[model samples]
Target: MQGHGYGQPVKQPPHTAWLVLLRVLFVAIGLFSIGFLAWAMMLRLAAVTRRSLDWGLFIAVLAADILSIALLSMEPGDEIRTTSGNFAMFLLLGTLVATIAYYLAADIRHFMQREQAYAAQRTAQAAYAYRGPASPHTPPPMPHTPVPRTPPATPPPQRPAPTHIEQVRAELDELSDYLRKHDGRHDSHESGR
Candidate 1:
């Protein structure tokens, strides 16, 4: 017999790396905007100084970055009409967008760090409040209750003697033997007839 051989390899569609990269970029942009908003809110709540200025700068930088990206994406491009001016414009726009993105990212990182610190402080304060003796509102321990004991049982009362009719029934049973002897012959004659 011929030697056994391995099965043929299954083929798969080609990888769309460029499309995947573009999708990832769009997702990053959306997340960055959300994170920026959250950071701004946290800073305001924590009563940080100059929070308004910080937020204003952040918004301006983000707007500029988005506008530059939009303009660059809308620029005309064809297979045969590429020019040096167009390339330079694209590079400049990309650089400005990247710089603004980096500035916003740095600010967001700083705000997150401060928020985490505030959260930790609040947690520590709660722990202290629970353990402190200044408050007399602590719950009291549960009381233990004793089970009740049952009383001992008493014996039933003695019954009274039987009535006169019950005594007559006992006397009749005692005379049953004499009556049986006297009626034996009569009973046998009646049976024969």
Candidate 2:
């Protein structure tokens, strides 16, 4: 009646306190549902890499939602309506919010687990590079055994001597050295002239 227009029917506005209380209750229930789902999933995930599709909080939420709807359907002025399901729609909305949050949490968990597995595999591959390839110049790791300093009875097999490329490189190097020496001499003679 406070906000009623001259020709308009009286409209009842919900009390500020009741509205605030109902909103808070809805948010609290929704948050509780989400948190419960996340905690249960995390525990289950710890048991195995495969996620559990079954949610423990799901039954609780469904029960609460059903209870709220039943209470809301009661006639106004009935003791049931006043005592229970007073904020039926709000509680129902809360359940929806909780469900949405639960699914998001599951998706995030799956994505994060996949990323962790990929990173671990990549790290295992990189570990080979971290130690790096053995160089021919460096000696191989010696065995832990401590042998006497006696020389070998027979010499080890000799490696084949440097071949064609080595011969060509040596020849080219000698020719280059000769040309450099002559060029210096020619330069000095020209300077003198």
Candidate 3:
């Protein structure tokens, strides 16, 4: 009666196969993107007579693609026969969107960090400027000193002392007497019934 009617623990559907397929697809797409980007870089470099292919960006994109693919591929079940296929598709699509969003977010974060650093640098420069040279300079004439004022004294307020053990015991006894009287009345009424 404590167990389920099925007599066995329900098994979670396998999704491993679907994850593998999604990962493969993601990697394929990523490789394609990299190739395209490289080609684009080459064209740009050729046109300007300078290396414009940002290796850093290429590496970053590749790393992101790899990590995304890995995460998607680790999911469990056969993509062709199970619900995993649909899940794989959804995850792939989501990964693509997330990748783009992450890229934009990363760019924005980088820009903000750079801007903050620049502002901090400028602030430091301003502070240093205000400090001026360390060499000794002519000091200004001393101003007249004002007399110090004395503070008014006030008497301290008195506080009651803490209750001693005897006082506490007396209070506890009073409470006990009150409770016993109430209990006695309750018992007498119950017995009469």
Per-model TM-score on C-alpha atoms: 0.27, 0.33, 0.28
Give the higher-lDDT candidate: 1 or 2: 2
Q: Output the better candidate (1/2) by TM-score.
A: 2
Name the TM-score of candidate 1: 0.27
Model 2 clashing-pair count: 0
Clashes of 1: 0
In model 1, which regions exceed 4 Å deviation?
1-27, 30-50, 53-104, 132-193
Which pairs of residues have clashing backbones in candidate 3?
Answer: 14-76, 14-77, 15-75, 15-76, 15-77, 16-76, 16-77, 17-77, 19-73
Worst 10 residues of 1 by lDDT: 139-148
**Residue-wise C-alpha lDDT for candidate 3, range 33-134, written one tens digit per residue:** 642222232222233223233344445444544554565466564344445544544554554554544443443343444444555445434443443322
lDDT, each prediction: 0.45, 0.50, 0.44
Give residue 127's error in model 2 in angstroms: 4.4
**Predicted candidate 1: what Cα RMSD to the true structure?**
35.4
Clashes of each: 0, 0, 9
**Tens digits of per-residue lDDT for model 1 on 102-131?**
444553444545544555444434443443
In angstroms, give how far residue 149 of model 2 lies from its true place: 57
